[model samples]
Target: MMTFAVYLIVFSSVGFGSMNINSHYFNKHMEKLLVSRTFGLAGIRNIEDFWIFAEGPMLDSLFPEPGEMDGNIIVGGPRLRQAKVQNNSCEVHSHLKYLQDSCYGHYTISTEDREAFGPGTTSPWVFSHTGSDYYRGLVATYGGGGYHLELPSNKIDALQAIQALRQNNWLTRGTRAVFVDVVVYSVNVDQLLIAKLLVEFPPTGDALPSWFFEVSRTSLFSKSKDYYIFVCAMISMTFNVYFLLLEACRLVYLKLTYFSRFWNYFDLSVSIGSIISLRFGIKNYLFIASTLDKLPDGVDIPSFEILARNGFNVKVTTSIALSLCWLKIFYFLRVGSSTLAKIRVSVWSCVLNSLGFFMVFVLLVFAFTHLAHHVLGPHLHEYSTLGATTTSLLRALLWDFDLEELQRSRPVFGPMILLVYLSLVLTVLWSIPLAIFARSHTDVMSEISRRCNLWDQWKEMVWGQYSYRQGKVTSEEELRLLLEQEGLTDEDMAAVLSRMGVRRGQHVDSHHLRNALGCLQDAEMLPEVAVRWLTDLKQRVDAAGQKMVALTDKVHMTLEVASGDGS
Candidate 1:
């Protein structure tokens, strides 16, 4: 059993890493760059003439000189790689870039990096050393406890991916600045860092400023197989839903459940499992992250074999997800000897439809990821993590994001991204009123249906009672009496009168009474004739009012004469 579980884990992780995640080395390199750039939780900016990245550095000496600051500070695009050593020192490889930096304010360099700096720590610290060589600065912080021997460039790549996904952690700096664990990115002139800060860090038990959330952390280097498998499971579920819907529609159209039977239980097991994987299985094994990298075109290179190894968490999640898909595809599809086979034909087209729907989930994920990266800007991973990547994908679908200040911390087009998202929000908001109207209509219809049944039943009991003169009182008298006995309001009494078009002393034509009673809750439950009986009785009451009044007057006159004779 353990072996089987292990196999599943391995299968899932490997698949997710190789297939779902970008397999190319080039993409990984780009991710390295993206993650680092975004690490400036303080927020960075790119100028037309130059890209200005700002972060709180432990050693200020790492920045480039004034002369080198002009023009493009980075000579070439970043050279991305994993770190060789842990606890890499901090170096601001200025090559002369900080000359005209007007972006940052004076802030204390929180000295907690030593305690928090390391690989896979729950809370990571951005560490540094005052050195000119980017490589030297990198080595001081890479490790299992680190800035693990991963390059800062990799973080940049992660950030780039985040940006590509179109949402971000960017927000404006308010009266209280966002707490950013701005680590110095120490990389060679070739744009490669010897070490990178770990996403998770030790908080060092220090109480950070108000914007502590800005301080990003690293996550475990989990296998991607589970994520991929989970994704496939979701695709399968989406397809299953489509198939069932199609089969149901067909069944309704063709007047048979034969075509729809197969899909009847599609959502019953596989879908439930898929849902489970989506919520927990995938979550346990994989992480979502925000990155600053743009989508790389080619990813063919194999850079790090060790990093490619699947982790346990990655394996199990993937296996379970794939298992869900397999059950739907193979088990359910092949189980024809069972009685449920009768509906196979009806469900076949729907199965095809569901598979097609899976494509939609895939396309949507890609499309939104692309849009997010492009509009949100490239990720600068100075504070990126693997978990955030998955989250960004979800955000694109949900369209709920907040990054206004990060965009505004600097004067740039970054803040404008909110406008696009806000426009979408407005469109959704405008539709809400219509949605509410529809909901109200359904509720009203349902309520009336429930109550109408009771009305219908009551009407049958009273059908001939009034017409036969079996009841001594008229409907109006009954109405008044019912009010006293049945706890009715003046409103209820008024509605009955209004329906008949009858005033207290006046009689209305009985034609409209049936229509009014038909609108009641119990009408459907009663026989059709009962409604007519009430209608006919109302008319008799209106016509007989004068006769009843004369009788009352005669009785009163007799009583007065008797009283006089007795006196």
Candidate 2:
């Protein structure tokens, strides 16, 4: 029974571990997808120019504009609107070849522009007016020249312009920043074509801050393995619930009997906690995925990243819960056959014996902790506090001492103190306690073995083919064959039969077997022990039977005399 339970727990843990690995990879894939959508679209394209233009009011429309920032502004582009045509604006291209040549090696915002704009000037054409450092920095770096400076008619035109830039190598997939300059006219706003020009540049090794707004792709769910995650979570939770039910049934049936064991509570706690943790973990991921599904592309949902991070945390918790659930495998080794039972007993005996050693070791550790804190605290940083001293000593106990720290302390004195400490801790205290525990473990096992031998002998006699008026009768040839199979010689069989006093062709019963076993236990020193015991048992039985017959006769005579007197 115990073996079966152990196999079940092991199989469940393996399944859970596989699911955890899959979920981890799934999270990584999702993160990569997010990064591709957010950063890949605006990467630097042209090596020489290091500038890519973004057309129209791209991501600005996804968020509500700040009231303090001007509504219509072009941050880093030409101020004229198609040379101000009479009825409609005509496309006019401006040449900045002279300016580009001068700023080839020194691509920077014009000093006059910087002074006039003053970091973040609120104008219809100012990029920093929106108060976004990402766009503002891009405008300051690459918005000087080699820009399209066009107004897009719609969002599609804006997407096409970005895609064309990427294809033309003017906008690489690795660019980190995109600058947009929008010019909104209060009058003739519809004819103005609410559009902005974006300039992208390569990142300077510094990663974008977390608060930076990011664009998301439309097919968020398609890139993730949420289906597999959900399935695994469901399967794992179902198994945990099954275990919970089993524990409940055991509690109901065994009542106090089940509660008496410590492992029962451990299993119950793991089962309940795993169920709860897995449920909440699944809920968190699903909620985040659903929320992301409802959001439009290029929309900056601030909570999306936060929710993703929270989901990852829950995933870690679920993994930990799975790990804790594996502790139940130990509970299954306590029952079943005598061999397993003996193992359980011996292991528990070792644990109980080790407690004494642990108690003594803890006291010694505290003493050393105080000594280290006082003596070595001034010289070594590790020993500066009582907690630190205790921690250092604990690590030292495991042979993980920091040699550098010891060497850095008062050179000779530190080595001498450490040597003495190691001598007391490793050589004497550690070895002695472990040795004591080992001795106790051996002694307990030896005693258990001795008792188990007697148990085996009794069981063989009472249950095997040797009991009197019970169990199967074995012929002499059959018995000889069995002994031969056990590696016993013919002489050994003959001696055993002689000790039991069983003649040729006579059936041997439980009495003969019991006597033979008793003689064996005493090294064949008292072969007649079982004979004497059987004779005594027979005499007692015969006496009791005679007493019973007499009692019956007396009862009948009393009844007949009473009837005659009545007549």
Clashes of each: 136, 19
lDDT of 1 by residue, 494-559 (tens): 765565565675433334355555554332334333344445555789779978999899999999
Give all candidates' CA lDDT scores: 0.37, 0.49
Candidate 1 residues lying further than 4 Å off, grouped into runs, are 1-263, 266-268, 271-412, 426-567
Residue 19 in candidate 2, Cα distance off native in Å: 7.4
C-alpha root-mean-square deviation, candidate 1 = 23.4
Please write out the lDDT profile of model 2 over residues 1-567, one tens digit for every residue.
554355345435433543434333433332332223433323324333222212322333322245633333322222211000011112223475444322211123332122121122333223322222212432233332222223343445545644554465432223333333332222212111112234333222322211122222212234345455455556667777778889999999999899898888887877776776666665655665665565444322224444444444555665666666565545554443455565566567678657776777778788888877888898775887787789888788788877777777767666666677777777657587667657766876678565545445544643454443344455555566655654455676687777667778877566776776665543123233333434555698999999999999999999999999999
Highest TM-score scorer = 2
> How many clashing pairs in candidate 1?
136
Q: Model 2: residues >4 Å from true position, as ranges?
A: 1-226, 290-316, 333-340, 350-352, 378-381, 428-430, 452-567
Q: In lDDT terms, how accurate is model 2?
A: 0.49
**Candidate 2 residue-wise lDDT at 225:** 59
